[model samples]
Each structure stands twice: as C-alpha cells, then as structure tokens.
Target: MSGIKLICGKELDRVFRDRKMIFSVFFLPVIIMVGIMSLVGNLSNNAQKDVEAHTSIVYIQNSPVGFPQFLKAADKDCKIYEMSDWEKATEMIKNGDADLLIKFPENFVDMVSGYKQGDVIPQIKTYYNPSEDYSRAAYDTISTGVLEAYRQSLLSQRVDNMEGLTVFTVNSDNPDMVIQDEEKAGGKILGMMLPYFVTILLFAGAMGIGTDMVAGEKERGTMASLLVSPIKRSSIVLGKVIALMIISGVSSVIYVGALVAFMPQMIGGADLGMNLTLNPKQIAMLAVLLVAIAFLYSAIIVLVSVFARTTKEASSYVMPVYMLILVLGMTTMFTTKTPGEWVYAVPIYNTSLALQGILTQEVTTMQYGITLGMTLVFGAVLIGVIGKAFESEKVMSI
Candidate 1:
C-alpha cells in the first residue's frame, strides 16, 4: 500500500509539475467548449434573423377586386408582381423569381356580393412551393390575411341584417400545474445537450492522461525500470491507475464547472430562458454519477494504454473508443425519443441518460445504483486487465 502511494504520488507530481499538461488537460477543454458553443449560438441567431428579415414576392392573376388591397394593407412590405398567365406564374415561382401565385375569377366580387349566409361559398386558389422559404412565408401571410379581409368584407355587408354567428373558446388544463412553453423548450434543450457535452469531456480528459501515463512511459522505458524495481507489479499498476483516475476526474470536474459557469453566457448571453434548475440532492447525485463514470472511462483508457507499446498506438486505439462515446452520448441529443429504461444498464449510454435526467429534473434514486454499479463493474474488469498487463512483459513492453 505504501509502495502504491509513493509511486502514485510520483506520477501525480510529475504531471502537476508540467504546466503544458495542466493547461491541455484542463483549460483547453473549457476554451474549446466556450468557442464552439458561442459559434453555434451565433450561427443560430443569424439563421433566425435571416428568416425574419426575408420579404415575400407575390404574383397576381385575374386579380380579385379587393384581394390586392387587402394583401397590401396586411403587409405593406409585400412585393406585388403581375404575370402573363398561370403558366408564367408557375414558371416564375418554380424559378424563384416569385414567391406566391394567386388566381381569382373575373366575377368573384359579384358572387360574394350576392351570396346568402348559407349559400355555397366561392373558392379561391393559391400556390406556393413548400420548400422555398419566401414562397412559404408569402403563402402564410397573404393567404391568412386575404381570407380574414374577405371575411370582414362579407361580414360588413350583412352587419345590419342578422346576428346568426356565435363563437366561444373553452380551456381544460390547469394553468398553475401545466408546464410553460419556455420551460418545455428549455427541457428538450437541456435534457439532450448536457449529456452530450459531459460525456465527451469525461472521455477526453481520461484519454489525454491515460495515454500519456502508461503508453508514454512504456515507449520511453520508464515503465520497464519501474517494473524492475522493488515495488510489486500490482502496486505499480495500482499507483498508475489511481493517478490517472484522479487527474482525469479532476480535469472532468474542471470541464463541468467551466461549462456550467460560462456556457450560458456564451450560448445565450443573458437570462437564457432555459429555466434549468437542479436541487441540491440531484446535483449531489450527479456528482456521484460523474465521478464513477469518469473513473470507469479512465480505467478503460488505461487498459487500452497498457496494451499499446507507445502513446501513438494507444491514441490510435483510443480514437475508436472516443468515437463510440460520442455516438452513444449523442443518442440523447440527436435522437427524437430518449432511449428506454433497459438502456440505462448499458454502460456509456447509461451515464449520459442519467446525467440528462439529473439536469432535466427527471432522475430517480434507483438510477444512482444502476448507473454507478454497472459503471464500477465495467471499470473493475478493466482494472483487472491492467493489473494482468503489469504482470506481462510483452504487453507492458518498454
């Protein structure tokens, strides 16, 4: 035990002494997270701005008496266009030269003027490309506006004659208990996003130190000298594993802290409206899950590092594991439906889902046992492999 502590302290001291290692393992992640999130937020805001700034162009054919005036009154910014025929209008819309096409019968106003309350209503046809943003926008604005304006016109014609229409709207749900729109929006965003970032950071922190500890040492011959010393092979492996776990776990915590502190500012800039809140117990459980998962990731990375003869080879091997973690972590963010309960026992994904639940106010106490227990079990198996590798000259080759 003393040997393990001594060797562990030596490894930790060596790592802490290097300023570059400290910055790369801890600070770099925070910087990248902030930069990427800010870029995403900016791009998103730009797209929405473009959508709102857009103006629709309309093509009129056999124009109704008051439809054009109604459209102009509804949105004065609309650009009115005239086409030779339906064929020209279709071609114009198809070529993106126009956004929407409206056609009306020459006598359409006379029909509306003579109609009874229950008579067959005149029909108007409108066309717009569903794929074109301008076309869709024009259709939505002009169609709804023209309909309302025409209704008001008909209503005015009968204003003094009758009072047959009566309309009332009813509500059923309790306003106090139902979730707000912003809260639902915040829920989906937080539930999916938190898991993706945390899991990737966990894997990244472990990969950086784990590869350097065992594989870098093996390549440089330090591991061989250490193995040949008075210390037991188990003690050496245990010391190294402990150092890796602590370093990677601490680095992961730093990453999480930086994310929680600065991400909202970078991503949303102020009062993000995310409405994300976690109680004390939930946060404590989240820390427990994160620590256990981080240890598990470190053990797996160390196991891979032990098998490789050099840091480069270890990195090559670790890349796939990183990719796997990314895919699994993204399951929550990219997937339309959260994975089922049975998935929570499946190692990497379980941690991500549990983290999502914790942040989104949906986690249960049973999740702590399931996620922590399975992750520990997975980590133990990897630790056993590392110990066995310490006993093998071929695998731990200098």
Candidate 2:
C-alpha cells in the first residue's frame, strides 16, 4: 500500500509541477472552446442580420393591375420588375442576379372573380434558388405574407360572410394547452449534445498524457528505474492508473465546465430552447458515472502504452480505439429513443446512453447499475492485464 501511494504521489507531482503540462491540460481547452464558439456565433448573427436587411429583387410576368401595390405593401424594399420572358428571369435567379421570379396567369384576377363550383383553380408559379440565401428569404416572405393575404382578400369578396368558411380553431389564443414537462423540456437541446461532448472529452483527457507516461518512459530508457524499485508490479500499475484517472477526471471536469458556462452566451441572439438544470441526485450520479468512465479510459490507455515500444506506436494503436469511442458518443447525439435495458451491459456505449438518460431525467436505477458495474469490471480487468504485462521482463526490457 505504501509503495503504491509513493508511486502515485511521484506521478501526480511530476505532472502538477510542470508548468507546460498544467497550461496545456487545464487552460488551453478553455481558451480554444470559448474562442471558437464566440467567433462562430458572431459570424452567424452577422449573416442573419445581413440577410434581413437585404433588398429583394423580384421579376413578375403577367401580374394583375394592382398586384404591384400588394408586393410593395408587404415589403417596402422589394424592387419589382415586369418581365415578358420567364427564361431570362429564371437564369438571373439561378445566377444570383435576381431574388425571385413569379409567373401569374394571363387575366388571373378575372379568372378568380368568375370562378364557379367544381371549376379548375388558377395556379401561381414561383421560382427561386434555394441555395441562395437572399432568394430563399424573398420566396418565404412573398409566399407567406403577400400571396396569402391576396388569396384571403379574393376569398372575402366571393363569400357573403368570411366566418362561414371557418370550421374550427385549434388553441388559437391559449398556448398553455401543452402539458409541459419542465424536467424533460428544460435541457432538451443541451441534453442531446452534452453526452457526446462529455464522452469524447473524457477519453481525450486520458489519451493526451497516457501514452507518454509508460511508452515514452520506455523509449527514453527510464522505465528500468521503476522496474528495479522494491515495489510489486501490480502496485506500480495500480498507482499509475489511479494517478492517471485523477488527472483525466479533473481535465474532463474543466472541459465540461467551460462548455456549460459559455455555450448559452456563445449563441448570442439565438435561442435553442436550452435550459439545463440538474437535481442533487442527478448531479451525484453524473459525477460517479464520469469517474467510472475516466477510470476505464485510463486503464485502456495505460494498457496500450505498456505494450507499445514508443509513444508514436502507442498513439497509432490508440487511434482505432479512439475512433470507436467517437462513434459510440455520436450515437447518442441523434438517437431520440433509448435502447433495451440489456444494452446497458455494454461498456463505453452504455456510458453515453446513461448520460443521455440522466440529462433527460429518464434513466432507471437498473440501467445505471448495469452500466456502472460493467464499466468498473472492464477497467479492473484491463488493469490486471497491464499488471501481468509488467511482470514479463522480456516485454519491458525491450
């Protein structure tokens, strides 16, 4: 026990005492996360504002006498032009020279006024480039605002009473008709994304320093010093794994903290309906789950580091496992429904599932139990394997 403690203390001190390691592990992530998110948010908000303030250029063929008045009324900045040929106008829209092209049938107003029961209705055709932001915005505004209002006016003239056309209204004035589950609704957007980020960051935290700890030492010919010490092989392995787990766990917390703190502010004027709030019990469960995940990640990294001949070799071997972890975390990002209970028996994947459930306040005790138990079991087994590897003198001497 004393030997294990000594090894653990030495490893921890080595990391903490290094200024470069402290800055890279603890502070660099915070700076990059906040800087990137803030820059993206500013750019997005600027683009939206530019779109809103842009003046739309529209071409209309065979428009009714007063249709231009309606277009100008809806959007004062809309520049309307009369076009005899539509092919030229369509090409202009596609080429970004114009925002929209609308073709109204010849004598459209007369046809609507003279329409009878069971007669074919007049069709209005519109063209715009969906890839162009200005064209798409102009189409949406004209379709919903100007065109809808014109249709309603024509219908009112045809009917004796407009109220006769209405059958029923669906919660028109009362928005409280929704049975709001505040618990699940609060963190809806954040919940979907949080698990994926947490899972990836936790593993990344371990991967950063893990390879160099063992494999790097071997390459530098310093691992011999540890092997010759008056310490059991298992004790050395345990101490190193524990120290790595603690460092990675703290690193993961810093990452998660930065995300939670800056994410809302980073969105600026936009609202994603995110309102994450956790109860004490949920917070406790999350902490324990994160610790277990960190421990598992530490064990795997150490095992890989132990077997590799150099830091580069360890990194190459770790890449496949890193990709697997990335895929597992991404599964929860788009998954709307939870899987069967037995799925919790899986190791890294279960951590993502459990995290999603915990955020949404939907995780069951059994699910948590299965995931936690399986993770700890895998971590222990990996640690044991690493200990056995350490005992093989031929493996270490190389």
Candidate 3:
C-alpha cells in the first residue's frame, strides 16, 4: 500500500510539473466545452430572435371566409402579405425570405360550410416548408388558433338554438404542473450530457497517463533499471496503475467541476432555459462516480499499454477502447427512456447512466451501489490482467 501510494504521489507530481499534461488534462477540455456551448447558445438565440423579428407571411387564398379575421389577429404579431401566386409564396419560404406561407384550397370555404351542415367535406390542405423550423412553428400556432376559433363559432350557434339543453363543465386539477416547463426539459438534456463528458475525460486521461507510464518509460530505457531493482513486479504494476488512476481521477474531478461551475450561468442565461442549480450533495455524488470511472478506465489502459513497445503503439492499441467507452457513454444522450438494469451491468454504460441519474437527482441507492460495485469488480479484473502481463517475458522484452 505504501509503495503504491509513493508511486501515485510521484506520478501525480510529474503530471502537474508537465506543461503538456496541464494543457491537455485541464485547459483543452474546458476550451472545447466553452466553444461548443457558445456556438449552440448563439444558434438558439438567433433562431428565436429571427422568428420574433420577421413578420412577413405570404398566404394564398380563394375567397375564404374567417381567413380575413385570422390574418387580422396574426397581423398583431407580424405583417401578413397575402399572395395570389402559390409558387412565389413557396419560394419565399424556401429562400428564407418569409417566415411562413399558408395555402388554402380553391373550395376550402365551401368544404368547411358543407361539413358544418353535416355533409362530407374534402380535407383542407395547408402547405408550409417543413425544412424551415420557424415556418413549422408559425404554421402550427396559426392552425391551432384557427381551429379553436372555428370550434367556438359553431358552439355559439348551437347554444343560441338550443335553449332547453344544458351544458355542464367539469374541471380536473393537475398536480405535476410545476414540472411542465422548458427549463425542466433543458435541465434533463444537460443531465445526459454531464455524465457522458465525465466518462470521456476519464477514459482520455487514463489513456494519456498509461501511455506515458509504460511506453514512455520503455522509450527512455528507464523500465530496465526499474525492473533490475529488487522491487516486486506486482508492486511495480500496482504502483503504475495507482499512479495512472490518481491522474485520471483528478482529471475527471476537474472536468466535472468545470461543467458544474458553468452550468447554471450557461443554462439559465442562455436560451436553453434550464434554470437548474447543483447542490453540494449532487457534486459529491458526481465526484464519487467519476472516481470509480477513472479507476476502472485507468486499470484497463495500463494493462493494454503494457503490451505496447512505444507511445504511438500504445495509443493505437488504446484507441478502440476509448471509442467503445465513448459509444457507451453516448447511449444515454440519444435515449429518452430511463436505462434498463442490464445497461447498469455494463462497465462504462453503468458509470455514464448513473452519473446522468445523479445529475437529474433521480438516482436510487440501489442503482448507485450497483454501479460502484460493478466498476470495482471490473477494476479488479483489469488489475489482475496487468499483474499477469508484468510477469510475462514479452512485456519485459518490449
């Protein structure tokens, strides 16, 4: 234990002293995150502002009733430009010159009236470019308003003619109304991203440290001298793995902290509308999960690196492992439903999913314990493999 701790301390000191390590482990990740956040923020803001500022909508009509009133109401939000040419109106939407384009069939008024009189009416067709996001939103709002107004007009006429009929209204209250907001939805998205980023940094940091410890030492001819010493081969592997784990673990902590520190300002002030704040308890849970991920990834990378003769070869060998971890971490990002129990049993998947659950404050004690236990188990297996590799003549020859 003392030997492992000594090696851990020495490796950590070496990492801190190296400018390249400082830049890669801490500076580069933060810069990449901030750049991505800024670009996404700008795009969202521009989309919303463009929708609000542009008011020119082209509508093609053939003497439709109530269409004038709909246009009048929508005019309060934006200027309505009614066009006779459907091709031109469509071109306007396609070229981004118009916010929306509404097209009415030649017999739309007749069809609507016939349907009101209990006759079959042909379906009314409304055309808008689906490729334009704002056009889609504008058309959705307009269609909803028109339908509601038409329904009310029919209801009023029925009520005027039926004096003997009575209408009863029943109201149901919703208890979960507080959770119905864009801010909550954005927070949920962030929950998915946070854990995945932590896992990525864990894997990256582990690979970086493992390459430096094994292949770098071999390249520098320091491994031979270390082996010649009376130190046990198991002790050496344990020392290297412990060092790599600490480096990876510290990198994970810093990566997670950077996100947590910036999340409130980024999500709240940005257009994402996530008004979430992480407390100390959530931060602590994230730290624990990150530590487990770091240890597990470090053990695997060290074992793999031991088989490589050079840093380039070590990196090449470890690339597939990193890719697999990335794919597993990203599983939660693309999924809407909570992950299953089997997902929690997978190594990297468990850490990523559990971290997401922790961020959202949805994690149970059972899930947390299971993920941690699985990580430790995998770490033990990886350490065992590294121990065997250390005993091999091929590794020494390398």
> For all candidates, what are the clash counts?
0, 0, 0
lDDT of 1 by residue, 1-398 (tens): 99999989998998899999888878888898888887887777666667567777888777766667777887778788765678877988898878888776667778777877797787777888888777877787778876667777777785764334536434646567656666445655777777888888888887877898888988888877888899998888778888877887787788877876676666745445677556688778877887788778888888888878889999999999899989999987766575566777899888888887776666566775788889989988888888988897777664
**For model 2, how does the per-residue alpha-carbon lDDT over 1-398 read when each residue is reduced to its tens digit?**
99889888988998999999999888887788778888888889889999999999999999988889988988999999998777888889989999999889988988999998897799888888999999999999997678999888889989989989989888889967878676687566677777788877777877868998899899999899989989988888998999999999998889888888888667765776666778999899999998999999999999989989899999999989999998998987888665999999988999988988888888899999999999999999999899989999988876
lDDT of 3 by residue, 247-269 (tens): 77777777767876776444435
The candidate, 2 or 3, that scores higher on lDDT is 2
Cα lDDT, model 3, residue 154: 49
TM-score of 3: 0.84
Local distance difference test values of all predictions, in order: 0.79, 0.88, 0.74
Model 2, runs deviating above 4 Å? none
| Candidate 1 collision pairs | none
Give the winner by TM-score: 1 or 2.
2
Q: Which candidate is the best by lDDT?
A: 2
Candidate 3 segments whose C-alpha is farther than 4 A from its true place: 91-101, 105-116, 120-124, 150-176, 179-189, 264-268, 271-284, 336-342
State, as a TM-score between 0 and 1, how close model 2 is to the true structure: 0.95
Instruction: Give the candidate number with the greatest TM-score.
Output: 2
Ranking by lDDT: 2, 1, 3
